[model samples]
Target: MRRLLILFAAAVAAPVLAADPAPEIRRAPVPPQALGVAHTLRTIPEACARLQGEFSGDAAAPYRFAVVRTSPGCRPRARLVDAAQARPSPASGWILNDLIRVPSAACATQQAVVRVWRQPAQVAPPALDPQGRARVYLEDSLQQARAGRLAPLPAYAVSLQVEGLPCPR
Candidate 1:
């Protein structure tokens, strides 16, 4: 009987003890935009050749525009081009909450930027539908703007990171 009671108590406390604390969200002021163009010519085909334009100091859009070589060889071919906006997640380490893509271009890769707003997760009562399912939260800034909510502007510390695939050929 004592063992059974101890097992029950442990089961009751386990979830509470294992619960993860809310993540710390950091925010930083946006950096001033600088205008300039820097060209990098790579000697090897393996190295990426970069043409960077404008500087905002933000990770998402470090430059207003940037053109990079898609592959080591200068071959014209179709390639998959994708960009994702991500945030740190305790369970998964990072979660890609938003994504965008650009159509395949020529040998010279076209540049893209994925801007994200980093803010503390808001705790609110779930909005349940008639069937009792929780409403889906909108993560897209454009959708939020269409709904009349002003999306937070991107800042230096708001976004965790912006990942992109090699330029499409």
Candidate 2:
């Protein structure tokens, strides 16, 4: 009886001991280079043209800034302004976290009024700061694209609505 009880206890304890600990979430600060890149992208003709095309058809279409590392050539400029970890206003559970640049015309000067939103849950908070989270999301998007998961937006994304400036006519 003693042997059986010990074995049972050990078995129960083993599972508990072996269980993996939850991953620690941390917020990483936005790198200064990211801001520099955003500024560079605004001046790049190729990037401006791409933005023009992206918003031409549907100005309100869901979109996120293309990661600079992944798209070295031409991509929209986006910067994380708010982290999902912060408490959202009571009016909405979603937080406007990103601002993407929209060109007034192909290769013309740009304006950043496009707002991107993500729920607290979507960001998997505490692990990364707003910019860090955005980077991860952009990287994941690249992977998904390579795998042929051609969805317009990541499922976790809440909204990519244009707030101020509309795409130039």
Candidate 3:
């Protein structure tokens, strides 16, 4: 009788002890519009190459890479701006121009910046959502454009320390 009670208690407590396990956080790709580009980087050198290709220069310009949270979901956004005020918004799942990691080292920090530009009536600006889902739209074609009619503005960002390349100075 005592053995049966001990077994029952053990069984009951086992499941209870296992309950409330740590929450699993799933990681997804960052959106393009938020970062001005859609590319995912493993290193800062790769990011520099991307930046040079996009802006035609290796020097650092105004840019940002970040993950934004919204009411419905989360997304990444990247953007790049030039000295001529030329801004290009990245498409969904597009490659980023900046790398976030150093050789065999993780990124120290990652951030995203939002830039707004005023265009003429006929001039088309990069698309943006009023509720801030531009990252989603830019990252995923299916998610393009939020409920509002306003197009999302172009944003540029960078991911660091991705595939073991050294981070940019």
TM-score of each: 0.19, 0.23, 0.18
**Cα-based lDDT for every prediction:** 0.35, 0.36, 0.31
Q: Top lDDT: which candidate number?
A: 2
Candidate 2 worst ten-residue window by lDDT: 29-38
Q: Kindly report which residue pairs in candidate 2 clash with one another.
A: 25-126, 25-127, 26-126, 26-127, 26-128, 27-128, 27-129, 28-129
Q: Give each model's clash number.
A: 0, 8, 52
Sorted by TM-score, highest first, which candidate order results?
A: 2, 1, 3
Residue-level lDDT tens digits of model 1 in 12-95:
545743543333332342222223434321112222333333433344454454446655666522221222344334353333
The window of 10 residues in a row where model 3 has the poorest summed lDDT is 49-58
Q: Which segments of candidate 2 are over 4 A away from where they belong?
A: 1-90, 107-112, 122-169
For residues 13-104, write the lDDT of model 3, one tens digit per residue.
Answer: 45633542221222343332222334333222211223211111122542333332222332323233341344323333222332221111
Residues 117-141 of candidate 2 have per-residue lDDT tens digits of 4344333323566577634477877
